[model samples]
Target: MTDHPRSGAHDRLVTSLGTSIVTGELPPDSDVDPVALESQFGVSRTAVREALRVLSAKGLVGARPRRGTFVAPREQWALLDPDVLRWRFADRVDGVFLDELGEVRLTVEPTAARLAASRRTDRDLADLEDALAAMRSAGEKDADEQVTADLAFHDALLRAAHNELLLQMSVVIEVGLRLRDQFVHGALTTESADKHAEVLLAVRKQRPKAAETAMRALIEKSIADVEIAKKAI
Candidate 1:
């Protein structure tokens, strides 16, 4: 598939605008004048319009027939969008945001684990095992590797559930996992590895109840760690 001719300009504008809104530089409800943006970014009006269209889709901005485009309210922002999530995490880790994200994981991940326990194939199990092995080898000392492996483990679990809708959530889950690990240092290490082991064993044994419980415990611990880190920050 060929890339859009203006995709580069569109993406740059999106990132610039998204970061501004997320960082409060473009305050909520403030007008986002396309003409002004075009001049500032040195992009054409077409590129600016395309960028605003993308941002609107992501819930970062809103447009109306009479009123011009403007930054959306925080409640209206698509927190699940990976780009939006990353922008939020870029400046600081908001405790309320972390709690909201935790609530989402608490609602989704345990159920996914339960489903995976019943639906996972041999290949799925192998993927989970590979991620776990990577995690173990990376250990606490290698934070970046640990985060990547940890994300891989969760991604494998979500796919193992064999649900398209749940699988679609991989990006949001990935963003949350990455931000948590990156900002909340010392949260995922031997302790998290052990918890993941419980989940892996449960899935391996095809114990849906155990898998659900293990995942719940793991997420709960992560939420606690996030809270602790929030206090520290």
Candidate 2:
């Protein structure tokens, strides 16, 4: 239990460092020392080392032969690591990662919407409803709560579609959530939440074509929003 809060703080530091890397705040190929990093973050040396270890595991940072810890080049980032993904997404909302993630979402989510339209069971609809309700809770929810609700909304829709390939696409959702973790605000916007409602409405109404269209629109809008977010940098 004693380690719980400490563990969380360590994770946050790792995440913040990851954010710094992906956003170019910590430039590629730069050298880092634990003592310097510890002082910079105002954490203990052990915490700093542990956070660096976490980054190393995610392939964002590496220990050189004797040059000390160096920030990996941009190409070395483990794009699939959840931590990496969120950092990338949150790093600079206007980046190529947002555009790329949006493009992928367009390809994957509409199809998932179509499947859920045809195969979604009643319980699946209920789950979707629950997610929608959570989203409407007015005021910024916690980051984890946002991730959970965002993911739950997507997962419930995927389940409703019931295609084995669609079900297999859960990995994609996982990737998206990782991208979301870098946000200073709640993971998604009210606009995105509104679009999510449209998707849910189409699915609940059993309009497969409508659901597919709505899902597509949502993806397009999210892409636009991400572009806007990137401009803030």
Top TM-score hit:
1
Candidate 2 local Cα displacement, residue 193, angstroms: 8.5
Candidate 2, residues 1-233: lDDT per residue as tens digits?
12323576687788888888877788989877788777777888778887887788777898867788999987777776656666765524334555666777888899889878887888998999898777676436566666677788888887887777767667666665555445224547677788899998888888899999999998777666566656665
TM-score of each: 0.91, 0.62
Evaluate residue 207 in candidate 2 and report its C-alpha lDDT on the 0 to 100 scale.
88
Model 2 C-alpha RMSD to native: 6.1
Local distance difference test values of all predictions, in order: 0.88, 0.75
Residue 140 miss distance in model 1 (angstroms): 1.4
Decoy 1 TM-score against native: 0.91
What does candidate 1 score in Cα RMSD to the true structure? Answer: 2.2
Report the lDDT of model 1 for residue 39: 90
Evaluate model 2: give its TM-score.
0.62
Q: For model 1, how many clashes?
A: 0
